[model samples]
Target: MDRLSTRFKGTKTYLTNAALEASVNCALVLEKPLLVRGEPGTGKTLLAEAIAEALDMELITWHIKSTSRAQDGLYVYDTVQRLYDSRFGEGNVHDIRNYIRLGPLGGAFTADKRKVLLIDEIDKADIEFPNDLLHELDRMQFKIIETNEEIKAKYRPVVIITSNAEKELGDAFLRRCVFHFIDFPDRELMERIVKVHHPDIDERLVNQAIETFYQIRAMQRMRKPPSTSELVDWIAVLKSAGVTNTQLDQNLPFLGTLLKKEQDLVTYADQLAGGRRWRS
Candidate 1:
C-alpha cells in the first residue's frame, strides 16, 4: 500500500492535508473511484492530474456539463454522420466502429496499461448520470451497443471523480465510491501554496496580502469568498505591479483580482470606507 503522501510529494501541486492524503491512498488500494467533494477552487480536479503525474500514468479527463449524459463518457455513436457518409460514400458505413467514438471512460477501459481517469464536476451533469455510471465503474467494462462488443479494462484505472456539491448524489452511487471532502486550506497551508507560485515575493508583502485575503474571506457578507487560486493570482498581479507593503493601504484597486462577484466588491468597498455594515 503506497501512501499517497509519499508518492505525491514530488508533484507540482501541493496538498498537505492528512485526511485527503489518506482518502486518495485508500481509493487506490481498494481500486474504487475516489469521490472528491470540495469548494470550487480547492483543487479537486487537479488532484487527479497530480496523481497521474506522480504515478507516471496516462490521464483521461471527462469534464461534465449540465447537458452531459453518462453514455457521453463511454462512447457516442454518430448515426447522423454515418447516414450522411452513407449517402455521400465518404466513410465506411458498414463498420459500426467507424461511427463509434471512444470517450474518456471507454479510452480508460481499453487502454493497454492502467491510467488515471478524472471525471470532473460530476454534479454538473444530470441527476441520473452518476447512477448510470455505477455498473461500468463497478465492473470496469462497458458494452458498445452498435458493435455488440464488450470493452473491458486491461488494468483497473485510478478513477477520481470531483463534485462541487451543487446537488446531492444518490446513495447507491455514493456507496460504491471512496469519498473525501477538501476544505479551504488554513493560513499556513495557503501561504505555502502562494509561495509555491511566488518564491521571490517579499515576505512583508506576502504577509500583508494574506492578511487582507483572509480578512475578506472572514467577512460575513461576501457572496463569493476568494479561493486559493484567486489569492495566487492576486499575488502575481501585485508582484508584477511591484506593489509594496506601504502601498497596500492606498492602492487596493486589485480587489477585482480577489473578488469575482460585483456584490462582494461593493460590500468590501463599503467596509474599506468605514461603513457601519455591509449592504446586500
Candidate 2:
C-alpha cells in the first residue's frame, strides 16, 4: 500500500482515496484499463491527469462524443485528401501511408515510451463503441489495411476510462477492465479535500459552510445537487467576501456559485420562505 502510494499520489489540486489507490495499483499491475464511474463534478477525468503527472508519462486524451467511432481511435485513412492530392498532382499520391493519421490510441501504442491514455466519457458514444475497440485493446496491436502495416505497443500504456453512466456499457467490455465507483465523499473526507484546496480558510467558516452545504444536498426537491467543485468555489467566494460563520448561519451569499439550475434556485428560495433552516 505504501509502495503504491509513493508511485501515484494525487496532485496538488487533486485528492485521492484508499479505494481509488488500490484500484489504480491493481490496474497498473494487471495492465488493464481502470474504468471509473462517478457524477460529473467528481474527479473522474482528472484522475488520468493525476496519474500521468505522478508517473511522469505523457497524457493522451480521446474525448468521445455521440458520433465518435471506436475505429477512429486507432487510425484514419483520409481518402478525400488522397483523391484531392491525386487530382492536383501533389507529391506522393501513390503512397497511401502519407494520408494515414494515427489517433490518440494509435499514437500511444506507437510511442517509444509508455503514456497515460484517457478515453473520456465513453458512455457518450454509441452503445457499440466500447465493443468495437475490444480486439485492439485486448491484443494491444492494430493493422492499417491501406498500408499493409501492423503497429504494436512498444510499451503498454496506462489506460484510464471515465463514464457518467449516461448509457450502459457492454458486459464484455466491462469484463476486460478494473472497475471502481467513486462515491460522493462524506463530511470528514470533504473537509480534508476542502483543506487541500483552501488551506488557509478559517476553521469556523469551513465547518459552518460544510454543514450548510450538506443540508442543501439533503433537500429532496433539488433537481441538481451542488457538487464538490461547487462547494470549493462557494467557500472561496465566502472567504473573499470576508464572510463570518454568523453571516453564513443567517444566509448563503453568492448562492449562484453553489446552485446552478433555475429550478434548484427556485426550490431553495421556496424552502427558505417555508422556514427551512440551514442547520439541523
Candidate 3:
C-alpha cells in the first residue's frame, strides 16, 4: 500500500479509493472542510464516521434539512424554555447564558480533544446556508449572541460535508472547500465492499449475484438503482433462502431485495419476457 492508502486504509466496514483518500489528506493538511458530492448511497455520510474511527476521534454529525439554518450548527437560544421557566419562577431567568445551548459545531469547538464533524446533506438547506457558515468555519470561532460569549476551538476538528446535489452551492462556499466527488464503485471495488460485509459468502454465489446486480443496475429505466447497502441486504437474503449460483439468473430469486421501485420491477419482468432485454 502507498502512503496515502496506508494512512487512511479505511475502516473494515468502509473502503475508499485513492482519489478520496488524497482529497481527505489534502483537506486535513490544509485545515479546510472536505466537501463530498455523490449520488445517494455512495457512503458520503459514512465517510466522516470512518475518518473519526480511523483517527480515534469523536464524531459529531449535523444533519441538514430544508428547515436547517447555518446558525443551528453553532448555537440555539432556548427562548421558549426560558419564558416557561420565568412564568413558573423555576430558576434564574435573568441570566441569558442559562438559555444558551451549544450545537454540534459548538460542541466540537469546545471539546478538549480533536473531533470529526459531519455536515450531512448540506444542499438540503437553502442556497445561502453554506455561505452563512463561511465566517465561523474559516475562523473556527463564533460569538454566542444570547450570552455574548466567544466560543473558539481548543482543537480544530476535521470537517466533512456531504451533498446529494439537491441544490447548487455558492461559488464562495465551493472555493473554501477541498472538494471531491465520489463516483459509484465499479465491479471490482463493489466486490471488495461486499466481501467486507459477507466474508463467509460462497465464491460462485458472489460472482453470479454480482453479475445479476450489475444487470439490474444497467436498466436505464430504473428510477432508483439498488445501492451498495441494498446489494449487501440482497446477498443476505440469497444466503438465507438457500439460493445457488445457477438459480440466481433463472428467476432472480428474492427480486424485491434488489429492486425497490414498482416500475423498475415491472420493467425488469417485461425485459425478461423479451429475452433478457436489459443486455446491451
Candidate 4:
C-alpha cells in the first residue's frame, strides 16, 4: 500500500512512522473514516492537516465541543429566523435552502471535489454523537429534515477523526472507522521533526535540547510531560536566545516553555535544586 510519507504543505512535517503511514493509506483506499487516538500534544490533529495537504484536497474541519450535537455537523435549520423573515416579507424566506445552513459534514458530503474532513476532538462531544454520526459516515449522505432533501456526496471526502481519549467511544462507532494510535516521538524521530521546523538551527544546540527535553519527560512526578510541539517551541526560544549548550543546571530560566503546569514546574525546579545533574 502507498504511504503518507510526503511532507505536508502547510506544516512541512513528514509522518515517519510506518504504522501511521499505512493506516492513513488504508483509510484513503477503503474510503473509510480514520479514527486517530492519542495523548494531547502528540500531533493527532496535525495528522489530519497533513493528510489533506498530501492528497491536495480541501480541508473541512468540525471542531467538536462538549455541547456539540451530531446534527450540528450535518445541518441546522433556522425556523425562528425564517418565521421573522416571513413576517417581514423577505425575498428568500420561501426558499427552504435559505434557512438551511450546511454544517461541516454536510459541506464535505456536498463538495464537488474530494476533500478532507477533520472531526477534531470527537471525545469532547456527548456519547450519543458518534453513534448518530455513524450512518452518515458509512453512507456518505444525510437528509435535511427542514427541506426533506437527501444530500449525497458528489465525491467521497477523506474523513479524519481525532480523540484525546477523554472518554471511551462506543464499540459500534469504533467498528466503522480505521483506527490508529500515535505514540510520542522517539529521539531520532524527534530530531527529524525539530530539524523540519527549524532547518537553520545549530545541530549541537538541537542535540543538547533533545537531551534536556528527554530528561524532563522521564521525570515520574511530571503531571504533564512536554509534547513534541512544546519541545519545538522551547527550541525556537532557545535558538533566539543563542543557547549554545544544554546547561542542564542553569536551564531553569527556560523551564516555562517546556512545562506548562505550575505543579509540574515546582517538581522540576525541586529536582534541579536537589543537585540532579543533566546527563549528556
C-alpha displacement of 6 in model 1, angstroms? 9.1
Residue 97 lDDT in model 1? 87
TM-score of 3: 0.91
User: Per-model C-alpha lDDT, please?
Assistant: 0.85, 0.88, 0.87, 0.85
Note the residue pairs that clash in candidate 1. Answer: none
Residue-pair clashes per prediction, in order, are 0, 0, 0, 0
lDDT of 1 by residue, 60-149 (tens): 999999999999889999999999998999987889888999899999988998899999999999999999999999999989988899
Q: What is the C-alpha lDDT profile of model 4 across 1-280, one tens digit per residue?
A: 2323432233367655778877887787788899998778888888888888777889999999999999999999988999998999876887888889899999988888889999999999998889999899999998888788999998888899999888889899899899999888899989999999999989998998899899889876789999998999999988898878776764554788888999887778777777344342
**Local distance difference test, candidate 1:** 0.85
- True lDDT of residue 80, candidate 3: 97
Query: What's the distance in Å from true for residue 178, model 3?
Result: 1.4
Which TM-score value belongs to model 4? Answer: 0.91
